[model samples]
Target: MTSRNWLTTLAAAALFPMLAHAASEQQLPSEEGQLTVSTVADGLRNPWALAFLPGEQGMLVTERPGNLRVVNAEGKVGPPISGVPKVWAEGQGGLLDVVLSPDFKRDRTVYLSYAEEGEDGKAGTTVGRGQLSQDLARLENFNVIFRQAPKLSEGNHFGSRLVFDREGFLFIALGENNQRPTAQDLDKLQGKIVRILPDGQVPKDNPFFGKTDVRPEIWSFGHRNQQGAALNPWTGKLWTHEHGPRGGDEINIPEPGKNYGWPVATHGINYSMLPIPEAKGKHVDGMVDPHHVWEKSPGISGMAFYDNPRFKAWDHSLFIGALVPQELIRLQLDGDRIVHEERLLGELKARIRDVRVGPDGYVYVLTDAKDGALFKIGLSGG
Candidate 1:
């Protein structure tokens, strides 16, 4: 066998001795049976997000330290690509997410979100678009498309997740920047979901357009640090997950012009263990309730709608990565509601940072660690 195959076989043998016995006995699950997990790529530094190319030859992955690497199907990591913008690189800051444009095959354009340093020593989440060079080893035409206005000094809460809807509109999730009162403010983009054209212009039809009280880009407000956001492929609804203080992590269905109770109303307490008054009722009138809430936070990170057919049973379900719980949580959806949730791969003992369905219909996971790894979940046998 080739060296690469030999190495992979050796690694698999060492990591999962159970595979050997099962393979000999032909006792592996069929295509629709129990899930098997295997490491695909390794030796990464705090890998954050992954985006599959159109043909699935490889994927682009982001590292929190501002590096991007291409991992091929064989689990080989390429040299870091150049032309990434400078980032603040402080606590919970630095490189965040990488996503392909809706027309990636035609345009070769990619979008990135990071915590950028401002002139006055402040840092805020910024989104930029760039084209992959002909050789695919570098980036060109890099330009900042969107930046948080009136950047704040605090680095604690930059939401920085990007997703595109069926209408080709871009939505960016922004946090309160560790300023509790800002969640209630309508003038700033902080603590709000902003909708814009792919090129970053505020859509005139936006809910607050021409309104003096709210920022023109604001679609919804009152969010904490919404680290995870995705477009539900089945319903085209925007779903998001935000980190709460001591407890009360939330999963919300975001709607335009609506307010999601953050500090003003939450099921959670402050980091100091103090209580914030709940919204007048358990479910407020103007605000939306999470489809589900985590009373004990698991430090949720990235989320995506499972669109691949390989796992037919998982269609329309939402997969979220948990940092503290160190597992991948799958929430089954039944007509815009979560019917069930199953936590997978918790025994692997890795902090999952992001989850994506590969073009091949396999589930790919990016783990958070100093020497992080990319893992693939698939059926062992058929």
Candidate 2:
């Protein structure tokens, strides 16, 4: 038997507690019979987001210390490719997410989100695009597409995630810069999800378009620190989840021009454990309620919809990575309501930073650590 088959058998025999760590394999239930968790690569340093390249192009991974590299299917990690934009690299900052264009096979264009330095050392989230060099060694013709306005100091909440709509518009998620009131401010780009054409042009259909003294890219505002976002395969709508203060993390499907209640109304208290002075309970007159809310913070980060047929039972489920609680969460959804929740990978005991479903129908995850790793999960036991 191959090594993987051996481990799968050993895990079935309850022998994985020793042989399957770091390069670990764990077993679980599946409607198909059994699930297998396999480690694809390890020894990464603070790995963040993952983007799979076109056929035979391997996968690109961003390490938070500002390095981007490609890892092949055989688990060989290449040297860091050059031309990544400079990043703040402090607190929650660094090279954040890497996503390819919808037409990436033809364009070779990739989008990146990171914390950028502003005047006087203050920092904020920024987004940019670059074409991968033919040799796959550099990001050529790179340019900033969007930068959060009125850059603020301190490095806690950069709330950066990127997604594309059916119209091929880019949706950028940002944080409040830990400045609570900015989320309610129409003038600041902080604490808002903005939509822009891939080339950095403002869409005329934007809600704030033609409005005086407001950033035209704002799609929805009043978010706290959204770190995870994905386009729903079933509905074609954008879904987002964010971190809350002491608790109250939320999952929302923000409508165009809608206001999602954040600091102004929350189930969470201040980090100091005191009631937020501005909070008005969970409901407000005009603001929209979260489609789903987590009364106890999951410290949720990256998320993706699992519609691929490799795991037929997982179709329509949402998989999310958690930080503080450290687990992979699977939510079974019935429309917008969460009907069931399953927590997996608890045996690994690592903080999951990002999760994605590979084109090959495997679920991939990136662990958050000084010595991080990348994982690929599959199903077994036919």
Candidate 3:
């Protein structure tokens, strides 16, 4: 192993005693059957998100400290890829989500969301796209596609998760920058899910396209810090989740021009345990209710849907990573409703950051820590 990998291995071992041995594997019993948790790669510094590359190219991972690298199928982490944009890299900010273009095979395009520095010490979430070089070592021709307006100075609450709908429209989930009232603002991109064309152009049919007062890219509004997003294959709609203050994390199927309640209709109170200033009640007249709400916040982060045929018990399930509770949550789905909920990996006690269903039909997760690691879950004997 290289020197950096060796150091990371030692760090992971020190942080996670269960992974004391290099290449350790653990078998745990679950409702679906016996499952095996295997370490894929280690020594990632607060790893934020991951995306599986097409075919044999392995995976691309983004570290919160503003580094991006590739990890091979054999679990060897490569050097940091070049040409990453400058990031704010402050508390709860940095290089965030990464995804490939829908036509990656033909276009070689990669999309990234991050905290970017703006004028006079202010910063906000930004989205950009670049083409991957043939060797996968650099991002070529990168350019900013969108930048959140009226940047704030706070270092937290950059809600950034990128997804492409079935029709190939790019949807970006953003946060309110800890500015509570911005969630209700019509002119700013904060606290809203915005849809745009691949090249950063607003779609002519967008809800506010013809309106001069509102930001035309908005698809839906009134959200907190959304860290997870995915396209629901069954419904052809975008599903997203966000962090509430102390409780009340929620999931919503965002629709065009609709207003989902944030500060004005939250089940959660301030972090100080006081009621929110603007909230009138838990339910409001004109606001769209969450599809599902967790009364006790799980500190939810990344999310993915499982529709693979390899595991019958796991199919049609939604896997979400929880940070504060340190577990992977499996929500059994009956169409749009969550019928049952199962918690996985609480014994590990690691802050689960991002969850994704691999192309190989296994569930993969990133642990958020100074010495984080990549883990894969599969059938015990598979």
Candidate 4:
């Protein structure tokens, strides 16, 4: 940790003595079974995402305030690892996601998404990668690979989540920078999902690869603010979810060259309870509808698919973190369609920010708060 962070931690420890200790284990009831919620670690400041390391290396976690740290198996949060690029650190603008390379064991490479400032004080979502040092104290030779275009000055809606497909292509989800009209702009990177090579090169087979006046990196467009993304192991397709204004938090399977209607046609009204001006109706002729939607927005965030069989009851279910409702949503899938929904973790009442299926087949979640926590969910008495 830097001197500043060290001092901050000390001050926080003084005010909250529990900051140095993990929360007691809690048993909660779920539809499938009694669930065990264990605090792997706490005192994380607005942690946004986490990626488990190979072997016994613990896990890498990113705090939204632009700090990255490792939490060991003993649930000890280490000092911040060095070499993270400077971030905007404003509202919803900071270090957001961390993911390991597909060939992480060989390359030891790690990827990150964050809010980066551009010219004229504007900011946009950016992606970068670096090799992890052997000591795990810093990143080596980190460099940015991709950046969202026309960096607007808006502070919200960075819409960044990184997912590497089975074929090795990287998919980056972007927000419209709270600029509603940009969602319909084909020439802009805002409100679009872009596919690129691991090293940040545009893929030749991308939908708009050779198109004139369109971003070659764009795989799909017309998104609002996608915060959760994952590759479906069963179909090898990318799945994502985004927040809606007043209602209509939605799940979508983003495909190449597809248009998902955002401001143009929505299942939601504006935050002021008025109809969206650009919307023609809830359904539009040229845009694809969401695969699943929630009438009452849950302020959805991270997403994961539980394919592991350790918890047979949760096997093959989709897990989504909810910020507004402070729950983890388990959506039962029947092939390509959602057949049922179960909400979990309401007893914790913390903003569930990120969800991941651990290597041990247990479910892991991160809470979004001033003093956030990392929780692991498993069968209580299995």
Candidate 5:
């Protein structure tokens, strides 16, 4: 953490597998080994998400300004693919996460989430899906699948992270739209995680499907801004991390119809240094508590699990990307609990947006900036 150590780490980065952008390689020490953070592609505009396409084609990256494009294996970026919906790109609202269908190889379908503009210029989160054309230049038959209910007039906190479980159910993360109280409102879709079938229909077995006076799509409630979500491949349960108020960021294993107690059971206070009026000091009688809470936030963003043995030391570690601190974090876990935390990529100075572990056994991260980039994280000398 000293200047001399930081400089030494940078000097060591020159030894990574020198791809085209090798000159700017950055390095940092990891508990497992030394990590090489090298740009795989560049010239993107505020990329928010990434998904590897099937058949060795490449990766699909979604930019915040309403563009989706491909970054090929050789680090070549293709033109923006056509047919993406026009986004209400303002104040943290824009095109967001992209993911392939569980049956992508057969269906050639991809899903997209973005901030959709409404009447009076209000915006809210919306999800859609389309089949990628054979030539990769356009999307065909794209249709809106889900939209956040009661769209708010503000733009911040439009959480749009996406994840699909093995059962082919799609889960979408929605933020509370900066309306703090909305997070705990059972009747509202804001600040909730919702699940639907591949075609965007409510599954009959959904926990709240037959309930009254609530959005049937909601799987769980009381989240703030959940920008990171993934399924624990071992347990088949959904795991997510969310941005809390000034502090109190949390990690929760979202279960059916559970109340996460945002605003009511928070360990954080308002950014203005005022105690939240509804907070009951981090616990409420009927709500679930977070498995882990960061009293001093790192501005958590994207996350992914490293289960591959390619890097033995990184096994079972969850890699989290941070924005304000401009770093990547490694959270080592034992069973259901986080056992250790290691911070990396702090010196890179870019808002770490999304992180993904690729089939090739390398971890990929996207940065948030005008000339954002995709980076590959790997160990040196491996």
Candidate 6:
């Protein structure tokens, strides 16, 4: 089917609300019943992230090609919003995630992360904030809030995910920028989870704030390419997933000022199949180990915490999108640890790039493809 035609049909369906029921208690699907999957929108060019507005009116979606689209409840993909920065549009380096400010109702502020073009053919990830236009059609007052120091020449590893904490502070996930050594540098912001105020000021309480050797914005370091990060609703803890080269995708709970031991102590080897030194012990004294890990890579993307009542049975779980496995994984959490995992929609045959629990309490997924699709998955008892 044509991309436009598919979007038209899905938009029409979105006009009418669909009811969802709780799935059966068993981890596996019921023998006689099936979950319903419906396309809510299409024609997105590698949709990277999805965030719902205050009301159920619409949502803001990020296109990896440097476009921010407003998707209405009717599933219509509006025209690309302006004020997006010029990005390094190659090899996963383009416009990335978009997030609404915690005070969206009071101030219509929005945050965006992308691979900003740098001098002399260099490029690096940058985080920006701006106010959504009064009509919500475009962005205005756009300003760079934070930028990685010493831009790298490589086009890959821009872990540009944004998540706000309970204290209204923003945390940015930065990748190693294809330079493994940078991940261990305390002075550079690359390959680190940085904590900063909305205006790009470093937090005073940051672990290394006053330290002369470390950048004040660095919260934690030694990460490879962390793509997925979410705050647990129950515990308010930050959970992140970093992609390893050959295998060893990790799920970690980041602590202030702690080193994560990426290249120095990794379960995974290099892409060229070289061995990496393992952590001195199964669990290091100070470094955190992954609560759970994919010994085989699944190409993890965005993650979200499931707290809405629509899936009451699945409340307090972590939902992660997988690109290679092409599925949504629901991880049952028990006080900072993942107890169980359930794979959903592996049969869809699409690279699931982002998974979000919508304001309406349904699970929304963005597919990664030339003609990408937005899908809504709900429980429909057959």
RMSD values, in order shown: 6.7, 5.9, 7.4, 8.3, 6.3, 6.8
- The residue-by-residue lDDT of candidate 3 on 16-100, one tens digit each, is 3332222668887787778788898999999999998876678899999999999876788899999999999998889999999
Write the residue-wise lDDT of candidate 5 on 1-382 in tens digits.
4566445444433322222344357787876778987778999999999998764477899999999999876778999999998898999999999999988888999999999988868888999999999889998899999999878838799888999998889999899888889888878889999999988899988888988888899999989999999888677888999998899999999989899999889989999999988898889999999989999888899889986545667778999899979999999989888999998877788899999987655788999999999998888765
230-256 in candidate 1: lDDT tens per residue?
A: 998778889899998778889999888
Please give, for residues 1-382, the per-residue lDDT of candidate 2 as tens digits.
4666555444432421211232557786654466788787888889999998765566899999899998865667889888899999999999999999999879999899999998889899999999998778999888998999988848878999999989899999899989998998989988899999998899999999989988899999999998999999988999999898899999989888899987888889998999988899889989998888889998999999987644567768999999988888999988877999988877778999999987666688999999999988777742
State the weakest 10-residue window (summed lDDT) of model 4: 12-21
Candidate 3 deviant stretches above 4 angstroms: 1-22
Off by over 4 Å in 4: 1-23
Q: How good is model 6 by TM-score?
A: 0.90
TM-score of candidate 1 versus the correct structure, residues matched by position: 0.89
Please estimate how well model 2 matches the true structure, expressed as its whole-model Cα lDDT.
Answer: 0.86
RMSD over all Cα atoms, model 3: 7.4
Query: Cα miss at 375, model 3 (Å)?
Result: 0.3
Q: What is the TM-score of each candidate against the true structure?
A: 0.89, 0.92, 0.93, 0.93, 0.93, 0.90
Cα lDDT computed for each candidate against the true fold: 0.81, 0.86, 0.89, 0.89, 0.86, 0.81
**lDDT of model 5 at position 136:** 91
Better of 2 and 4 by lDDT: 4
